[model samples]
Target: MPFIPHTEEEVQEMLVAIGAASIDELFDEIPENLKLTQLDAIPTALSEMEITQLMGKRSLQDGEPSCFIGAGAYDHHIPAAVWQLTTRGEFYTAYTPYQAEASQGTLQLLYEFQSMMVALTGMDASNASLYDGASALAEAVLMSVRANRKSKSKRVLMPRTVHPAYRRVVHNIVRNQQIELVEVAFDPKSGQTNLAVLEQYAGEDFAALVIPQPNFFGVLEDVDALTNWAHANGALAVGVVNPLALALLTPPGLWGEAGADICCGEGQPLGAPLASGGPYFGFLCCKIAQVRQMPGRIIGRTVDLDGKVGYSLTLQAREQHIRRSKATSNICTNQGLMVTAATIHMALLGSEGLERAAAASFQNTRHLVEVLTAIPGVEVMFEQPAFHERVVRLPAPAKGILRSLAAHNVLGGFDLSADYPELGNALLVCATEKRTEDEIAAYAQKLERVIQLQGGVTCGLVPKE
Candidate 1:
């Protein structure tokens, strides 16, 4: 809507025509206690140039910090065209697709999103989208329990290597619903799930087993073995994956002979920015046999009366429309806006472009590990091959070192002491393709200088370019 400020004369004429003396007289029905009569907190409005200058000063105060943390949200480079096209009025101001005939564009976009997710995860079908990665995993857990007719137990074998925050969310959401999350431990050496410990529960009945590729510690897991074992025990294999890593790693659909039954993961790395925490959508895809059990809305493409191509909502399980007990899920609306950006991002960067970015990220992470380990007391914490992130053992306390790094305008990796106390003084670092060689060297130099200082030590700051 365009703003057209009224002239004082025009306003007075309108007031006279309405039999009012002033604008305040038009609201005479309001009670005295309901009105606010002061504007003391607000400053006088400034001119355009003055406001622009003031904002520039504020932007300078908020320095552009270098990002090396990728616990769940990533800092991948987005193509300029992705957001440029997505933010156009047609896509940006769109709302829910309640009317199929009038909402063809929105419905088609969602249908394309599902198709892309199906291709990426190698699953039979995919819903529009879910809340975020953590909640999606929680939903996947519940879905597996309901879909597994072979096992009556609501027990799920959850690996300790999955993201700690995700586990907390799952427990909070499903604990009161009679779901039991049995945590499986990891091997200290490889940072991978211990197959020996898993063998102890060979014949036990469980609904599903969650397999995280490049588990929380960033170490790749034996996914094929885990998937096979889950199937042998009459359990469904649910894969918690990173969509970007799927460019180089094996898709969950081909994990074993019969393949993983379901796959779910965070979609931040696709195109969404890590603005503080997120606005990223979670993707869930499963085999055709269990499509009815999936949550959220699914868009289906079909031919109309004139043989025209069309898209419409299918298998909607809203609580308002079905019996309370028979409704498959409580998921109502899909995250259409976030998924729109992801679809554009994936389309711009075809399969080959995504592979190159993944490969570059892996190479940069490997190089970062080497550069940091060259310091006298820094070393890799795990022996298993990792993707783009790794847990490094630091000589000094991780919390203090990270605080000191922030002073240098560098946002270091996450400290694992609070979550996994067993790995004492460990830091999880990552190197996205965005990190330049100069940035890596500067980080190493500052880290080495910080490690050498016992007491109060003076260090030079390296301003970010």
Candidate 2:
């Protein structure tokens, strides 16, 4: 139970080999003040049977509430088959397919993942995967800097409405890279990136401009205008997009239609569970010209001497493992298991099914928004078009309202006031395809009651009785 397998003699022998008299001697370098004098509050060891019963009792107390939260991670429907397939010994236990010959299955799945990403983003090439969306954006920014060797742009512009974590990741990656991170402000009225501000910073010295599709506020930005502005200034446009939103909204490749050079984003909604925050995958796709600068691994199809179709690691020389510091990024592992799960999920859904799922989410969210805004004290934050998420101005403090919603067994939306002070009393609500009509209606009704009971109007735009 405790995994204390070493006998006393074995432990004494190990200590002798290390020139230590006892285990405590190994910690002699640590100061006494920093050492714990007593054990933690956890209970003493129990029999396995007793531990199981205790754990079962605690687990029963933790109930799963219907959730509405989706700032970055979402609660979309994951197919049962996805779990069954991903847990298979081949896909689940395998690590990096370092040797291409021994890992044909892993390599082929990576290849399929690349193909799906290419189709989804409308890009010429795609990498196997990265850590997550934020890291993917960081890698894309670095790649742009590398690709523009002659131009030597030292500035990168991102909109304020991009995910806060992503913005932080960019800052962290660029700190020692001698690059200036410029965050452009968004339009308060439209909740989209301010193109005029973008124009001011979009010069030859600017490396790339990152914009989120259906930005953090869930307002869809004018991709065509943003891309044109970035390109006209000789900078690349990097799109941080929602994979599900790509179903109804145009894919980032369409942004390429608008002149985008690189497209990257989180693929969590594709099938990956929001297990806490992750085990998520970051996708990077770009035009052929920028392929060499792309971080992470890429698998390609080839033929053997017998002329049979074969798969092998194609873009080896571009990564850190092969090229060291000169490589595009230090990332080595491709998030193989997560990528495989997403690939399998996408394969099952296909293009048409994905589009339909996206449409359902959009419709459900819009319906909920309309119902919530109808209440006396609630107000829609922006008139801009959105996908499955929307921001609403709350009559009462967002925290209080969220607490009340929680009491009613709902996981409420993210409170924007936590990050954007200007958006005081604003809550960012999200609805996925998993939300039933009854659940949406009930949430809206509960929100209305909570605000009204707190001496706040239900619809902010309406006159008090």
lDDT of each: 0.88, 0.85
| Pairs of residues clashing in candidate 1 | none
lDDT of 2 by residue, 1-465 (tens): 277899888999999999999999999999989999878797788988998999899876656777888898888888899989999998889878877778999988889999998888888899998999998998888888877654577788878999988889888987788887888998888888887777676444788888799798889999988887777777788888998888777777777445568989999999999877889999999988999889898889998789988798887898787899788888887677888999999999998988988898888889888888888777799889998899988887799889888988898899888788898789999888889989988898888788778878634446434
lDDT tens digits, residues 178-255, model 1?
999999999989999988898888999999999998798889999999999999999999999999999899999999
Q: Mark the regions of model 1 whose C-alpha exceeds 4 Å error after superposition.
A: 1-61, 318-326, 455-465
lDDT of 2 at 127: 92
Clashes of 2: 9
Error of 2 at 391 (Å): 0.8
Error of 2 at 57 (Å): 5.1
* TM-score for each candidate, following the candidate numbering: 0.87, 0.88
Root-mean-square deviation per candidate: 5.3, 4.3
